[model samples]
Target: MGADELSATLWRGRRQLDFLLFLLETQLLHLRAGNWHRLNFTASELEKVLENLRFESLARGVEATALAKEWRAPDQFTLPALVEIAPPGVWAELLDEHRRALVSLVKDIDGAVAANISILEKGPDEARAGLDDIEILATQVNIERALAAVSEASLPFLRDFLGLS
Candidate 1:
């Protein structure tokens, strides 16, 4: 893929990550407030976001594969690999930094999501069985906040990559 194509692809992926972080934040609020009604709605929203993230990831994978092929790199090579292998350039370094931050946020979100799933798997019955939903909810909120902060930090790099004024 060409530079512009790569930029657009990364832009789309970054936006997907942003929206995913937003959905998770909203879900955290619902969990924290113990609003079962809102939680159900927000959970559905998260499901949709997760689906979108999946498709975006797939599209990015295709683009990255094309980029790797363009450079004659190994099939397993990815965008970050491209940056590391190629000579230092302004955009490449910026993209690599942003990607690393984005990846860290994803890991945080993933951990929070797994914890939320564990709480969910216990069910309402487990709440009666002495599971501290409030504590779990609080932990969930904190975890999500960390992810939101990371997403916020990534905004500048994303805008730069997209060539936004």
Candidate 2:
């Protein structure tokens, strides 16, 4: 695979990561509110996103491997390694940015997962107290903000896929 193909795959992966993070955050909110119904739906959606991410990851691996071979790098190259061996130009900088963003998203996902687990482990009264501490208005605002961010982030991918100028 060429650099352009690898770049496109990376973009798709990034979008998937963004969506995954949004869903996880939404799930956390639902968990905090003890809204099992909405949480179930969000969990289902999260699974779908995870599956898509898996495919994207495979494609990325293939493309990265090809690029590595083209650049005479080792077979088991990681993103950091790719960045190191990348030509001194835009591609290198772009790949490094992606690496950083992916790392941050993974960390955020971990935190959300841990928080959800902690809430689930709490006693009923404790959980209720936790929920009481959250402001309904603030949760609504956060949901709206996350939705807007996801939609805005998706526009460039939509335009590119549709061949829009």
Candidate 3:
């Protein structure tokens, strides 16, 4: 389901926690299928997505606290602003060789989505004329969709620490 269709049951503060945990479990299915997804949001969109989170009161740099490492208490930022900043050093993180492996995995998911859209828009007959590898295409599409859903329901590190959800 897209953002527009998300019900209050799914988005309410408490239920959202449980939903995120459920999402983490569901992601196991995608992992088994060798699928991973990357979330690429513009600064503004990222801000909007995290606006409701309780990160502000949370102490920064509390392990898994990327924001804390590079920032301080007096230096405040809105969710949108933090999205633009992308939690600490976005560029440095991308530059890491080890992290590149993770990037590649997520890139595969994004590529699958682009392929699916192309197939639908250009019509299956034309898109799959030569490389009509239906099985491979279908697998990628299914895995990609599952990963995207999990990405949307991602949880905070705090939840795990508090044993909340």
> Quick one: RMSD of model 3?
15.3
TM-score of 2: 0.71
Model 1, TM vs. native = 0.65
Candidate 2 or 3, higher lDDT?
Answer: 2
TM-scores, one per candidate: 0.65, 0.71, 0.26
Backbone collisions counted per model? 0, 0, 2
| Residues 1-165 of candidate 3: C-alpha lDDT, one tens digit per residue | 211111121124333343333334334433333332211212223233334444422422232134423444124333223234433554333323222332343344344434433332332233334554675476456544543443443334323322223
Query: Per-residue lDDT for 128 in model 2?
Result: 39
- Return the lDDT, model 1, position 123: 36
lDDT of each: 0.56, 0.63, 0.35
Clashing pairs in 1: none
- Which lDDT value does model 3 have at 106? 34
Give the lDDT ranking, best first. Answer: 2, 1, 3
Point out the worst 10-residue segment of candidate 1 by lDDT: 156-165
lDDT of 2 at 143: 42
